[model samples]
Target: MHAVLPVAKPIRELHDLRPSDLGPGILASTEPVVLRGLVAAWPMVAAACASADAADAYLRRFYRDATVNAMLGPPEIDGRFFYNENLDGFNFAPVRVRLDKVLDELGRYRGVEHQPAIYVGSTTIDTCLPGFHDENRIDLGGRDALGSIWIGNRTRIAAHYDLPDNLACVVAGRRRFTLFPPQQVSNLYIGPLDLTPAGQAISLVDFLQPDLERFPRFALAMEHALAVDLAPGDALFIPSMWWHHIQALEDFNVLVNYWWRQSPDYMDTPMNALMHALMSVRDLPPEQRKAWQALFRHYVFEADEDTFAHIPPAARRALAPMDGDSVRSIRAQLLKRMNR
Candidate 1:
C-alpha cells in the first residue's frame, strides 16, 4: 500500500552521474544503470524546459479538472504516448492553451460522447521557443533523434520497452516513474490482447497500491525496480528493455524526452536468438529437452573458445568491423530479415 518506491541513490544534481565520476566498470555492462548528471548541465536542462513549457502550461489548464476527462476516453493500446516510437518521423506534439479560460470551460463539456483525445502536436525548435535559456533549440541530427513533449493530468502510460536508450526531462511539476528490468517481464501481470493493458490505458497493476497477495512476484520484482521523481529541470535516462510505468503527480505535469538508439544500425544477435528458438520453439521430445537445455547452457551462455571457433573469421569479421559503414549495412540487412 505504499504510494512511492525507494531508490538506493537519491540524486538531486546532474553532475553526479558522469561515468568517469562514478568510476570504472559502472556502465561497462549491459545491466541497467542510473546516471544523475548525464543531462544535468544547465544548457541541457534549460533546453528541455524550453522544449516542453508551452505544452505543459496548456495541459495543466485544460486537464486540471480530473473529473471532466477522467473516463472520457478508452485506453490507448499503442505504447507510443510516453515513449517515442519512430514510425516514420519524430512523434512530437505542440499543445497550447490559455489556463484561465480552460478553468471556466471544464464543466460544460460533460454528457457528450466525448471523443477519446490522443493529442499529437507539431513544433519546430525555432518556432515553439519559450526562452528556457539563452540559445534554446537542439539539433536532432547531432543527437541521433529529436526531443518531444507530453502533458496531461493524472494520466498514466503503460508498460513497454523502447529500442533506444531514453532521457526524460521533467520541466514543470512532479511525476513518478516505476521501472522494471526486462528479465522480470514474466511477473509483470501484463494486460489484454497482447496489446498493453486497458488498450494501453492503465498500467497492469495500480502503481500506488500494488496488491501483493494477488501478485506476490511483484515484491521480488521490486528488488530490482527503481522509482524516480523528476522535477522541473531534472531529467532521467531509461536504458533499453527497461519496463517503466509513469504517472502524472500534479494537475499539469510536463515532460520532454530525448531518445537515441544504443547503436543506430546494430541488429539483434542471431546466434543468441537461434539458440532461444531451439529451446523454446523448435520442440524437443521430453528426454531431449533436458539434454538440449544442458547443451545450450554449456555451448551458448557458458560457452568458451572451444564452442565458438566453428565461427569462421570472415563471418565473425562481418559482425563488427573496423569499417563503420560495413557494420551498419550488415546491421540494416539483419533488421530487414527479422522484420520479415
Candidate 2:
C-alpha cells in the first residue's frame, strides 16, 4: 500500500532527546519531528523488543480486569476500519471487553495471515493500567497532558486532524505515519463532520488504494505528504491541526500518546464555531455572508491589538483576552441566545 504512492520526504529526526528536552520550543514547532529512541530505555519497550508475548505479559501485570471499548472487524475489512457501502454505518462493530481478553485475542491471532481486526484506542493510561506510568512516563514539563494507549494489529487509520498537539510513543511493534500540513485539509477530501468512525472527522480518500479519478485533489495532498516509520521506543511529535494517517505495520502494535493543547482549557473547541457558522452564516445572502466574513477576519482570524484598540478596556468585555470567568459568561450568553 505504501509503495503505490510517490516517495514522500522523511520527517526530520532528532536522537538521544530526554523527556526534559521536550520544552516549549519543541512543542511550539509546526512541523512533525521524529525522536528516535526517546523511550528506548522504557521497560515496556524492552519487553516489546524481546517479542510480542513478552510485551503482552508486561502489560498484563497492570490489567485489573477492566473492560475497554474496542473496535472489531472481520478479516475481509483488511484491517481498515471504515464506513459501510451506504456510508450510513460503520464496517466495524464497537464492543466492550476486558483488557486481558483483548490481549488474549491478539495472542490467538498473532501470526495468522488473515485475522479479525481488534483495536483498543484512546483508553486512559491511569484508568486501565493504574501503575503503568510509575514505571514508564514522560515529563511534559508541567503541562497536564492526557495519556492514552492504542493497541491494535495490522490496522490502518484514515487521515484525521487533532485539536491538541500530540506526542505519540511507539512502545511495541512497528508503525508508520503519513502526515500533511493543516493547509492540505481541502485536498484530503474530508468526510462528514457530524458522523465519524472516531470523534473527529477523517479523510474519505483511502491511502491504501486512493482512487485518483474519484478524488483528483488528493494528488495535490500527496505532493505535500511527509512519511516516517517508527520502531519500538521511537516517538513522533505531531503539531495540532496536522492531518495524519497511521498504519500499525507490525502484526501486534501498542502506542502510548500524550495529548495537550497550548490554549486555555476554558476556551471552547473551534469545531463548535464552525458548526454554528454553517447554520447561522453559510446560507446568508452572498453580500451578507461576505460582510460576516470580513467581521470574522477582523475579530477572529486576523485579530490583534489594533482590532480592539478603539474600545476602552472596561467596555471590551468579549474583546478582552479570554479567562475562565469571561468564557463562562460568554458561554452563558450564547446559551441564552441559542435557547431563545
Candidate 3:
C-alpha cells in the first residue's frame, strides 16, 4: 500500500527521511536519492487508492477555484511535450484555466479510448489552488519556499534542469523520472534557452525513440542515466541543475514538489552569469580562452578561503567581508558597468 509492488534499481534508497536530513549540507551527495514511502502516511495518498473520483474530491477540498496557467497538447504529439521538429517552436500551447475546471475535465475522460494531454505544470499552491499547502507539504527548512503542483494525464515533460533543489512527492498515480547527472550537461543536446517550453532548456533528442544518427552523443548520456518509478506516496529528491525527464504514467496523475535553495540570499542566480559568459567568452580563440579559464578558476571556481589574506581588513572595503549591504553595493556597481 505504501508504494507500487516493486520497481527497477540503480537508484540509491533512503528510508524514514526527516526534514533535518535535508537541511544544511544536503547537496554534498551529487546523486539522486529516493526517500522510500516518505509520504505514504499522508491522507491524500489514501484517497488516491480508493478511486479516481475520490482522489479528485480530496484535492478539490483545498482548492479556492482560482484560474491557473495550464498546458494543452493534441494527442497527435503522442504525449511527448516538447519543441517542434524544426526546433523553431514548441509543440504544445499554454492556456489559463480554473483548477476546478481541470478536475472536471479529468472526470470527463475517465474511460475514453484516447484523451488529450492536459497539464497544469508548476502552479504555485498559494496563488492558484489556495490553502492546499496547509495539509500537504514537506518539512524542509523552506518556510518561504513555494509548493508547486503538477497535474496531467499520461503526459511527458521533456528533459530539463531546474535551478533549485527539488523534493517531489507523488500524490496520485505513477511517475517515472529518468535523471542525468549535472556533469552530463554537454551530452544532453540542449535546445535554445529563449524558446523553452517552461523557461527551462530541454533536450532535443527523443529518449523513447532516439535518433542516434543525429544525436550521437546522447548514447553516452544514457549510459549515466538513473531511472526510478514512483507510486502513490513515494518521493524523490532532485538536486539543483540535475537534468531529469519526467513521465506521468497513468491516465490521471498528480504531484506536489518543493523547490528551495541552500545558498545565501545575497548570492545571485548563476543563470545570469551563464548568459553573460556566453556573450563575453564562449567563442574566443583557443589561447585567450585558456587564459580566461585561469581567471575564472581564481575568482569563480576556487573556494573563498583566505582570498584576501595578504591584506588588512581595514584596507579592504568591498573585498574584506560581505554582508547584505555590501552585496547590494556590488550589484549596483555591476549594473552601472552593464549600462555603460
Candidate 4:
C-alpha cells in the first residue's frame, strides 16, 4: 500500500561534494542536488557520529545565553508547523528563551510518551551560537552571504519557497526534505502571502495527512516532487523559488544554512515586481492583461542574448543592461511614478 502512494522521483546525488563544486555560479544554478557526505567531517556531525548524547554535549558548548526566538505547538498537531484553521495566524505560539534552556528541555523529553512540538527556526548563528561560523564558514569569494540555524525536536516546516539560493547542512540527528519545482507553485495550494504563519507563504496541504478531499490538486504537485532523507553531515543545495518541506525525524535536530542572492546585491527581489503586478495588473481586462503578459515576456522573462541585439545602443537607454547607478536611477523614477 505504501509503495502505491505518489512520491517524487529520486533526486540525483553526488559523492565527495566539495566547496569547489559549490562555486557561486554552480550554487546559483536552478538545478538542485543532494551532496552526500558533504559535511561528514564537520565537528557537530562528528560528535553525533559518536553518539546523540555526545552531539548534545558538543552543541551545549556553543549555546550563547542570548534569548532566542522559538515556537511551541500542541502535540496533537504532530510536529507539523503551520497556520491555524482560519488561516489568520499560526497555530504555534512564539517564545524567547536561552538557547541552553531549550537544549536542556529537549534532554528532559528523552523518554516522554508525548511532548509538545517546539522549534527554534531561522535564528542567526552569530546571535544563537556566537563562534559557530569560525569553523563552518564557506568561502564564497568574499560575497556577503547570511547564515541561520534551526534547532528543534521533531518538527516540520510546511512547504515554502525562499527568495534566494540556499545550502543547508544537517549538523545533528536526521532530516528529510521534500522539494517541488517552482512551476508547481499553483498546484501546491499555497496559503495567503500577506498573511503568512512564518515570513514566507506555506502550502496548505499537510504532507503527513494530506486532506485529499479538499486539496485534490496537491496530488498533481506530489507527482513532480522529490524527497530525500539526510543524515548528519549531509547537505542539500536548494535553488531559489524551489518549494521545500522539511521534517526532523529525530527527537532533537539541528540544521544550518547559508542564503545568498545569485544576482548582485544592488538589485531588489523580483517579488516586489510580483506584488506590484498583483495590485496593478492582475485585475485588468482580458485583452489588456494579455498585452501586459507579452510585454513582460519580451522585456523581463526572455533571455538577454538577442532581445536587444537589433536596437542601437544609444537609442536603447532603458532597454540596455544596467549597472548599480543605472538601477538606482530607474528605481527613483519608478518611485516618482508610483507617487503620482
Name the candidate that leads on TM-score: 2
TM-score of each: 0.56, 0.98, 0.91, 0.92
Give the alpha carbon lDDT tens digit for every residue of 1-340 in model 3: 1211112236887777653446544433466888778787777888997877898998888887589888888878878888877888778888988889988887787667688888999988788766666665566754456589888888888899998888888989999999988888888899997788889999987766777777777877877888889998888888889999999888889998988776777878888889988998989999989999988887668738576677787876776567888889989998999999
Model 3 clashes, total count: 0
Residue range 1-340, candidate 1, lDDT tens digits: 4433334233223445431243223322344444444434445344435544453344443233222111122234221343234322222332345333333333223222332223222222222334432333433334454455554444556565665666666655567777777888766776432333223322355555677677666666677777777666555667666788776655445566666664544445344575557647568687877787788787657766665577886776643333666767766886797779
TM-score, cand. 3: 0.91
lDDT ranking from best candidate downward: 2, 4, 3, 1
Model 1, which residues run further than 4 Å from truth? 1-143, 192-194, 197-203, 264-307, 310-340
* Candidate 2 regions with alpha-carbon error over 4 angstroms: 1-5
Which sections of candidate 3 miss by over 4 Å?
1-9, 16-29, 141-143, 317-321
Candidate 4, lDDT over the whole model: 0.84
Q: Which ranges of candidate 4 are over 4 A from the true structure?
A: 1-4, 18-26, 137-143, 303-312
Evaluate model 2: give its lDDT. 0.92
* 10 residues in a row with least lDDT, candidate 2: 1-10
Candidate 2 collision pairs = none
| lDDT (10s digit) by residue, model 2, range 228-328 | 99999999999999999999988899999999999999989999999999999999999999999999999999999998899999999999999999999
- State residue 155's C-alpha deviation in candidate 1, in Å: 1.0
Q: What lDDT would each prediction earn against the true structure?
A: 0.50, 0.92, 0.81, 0.84
What lDDT does candidate 1 reach at residue 183? 87
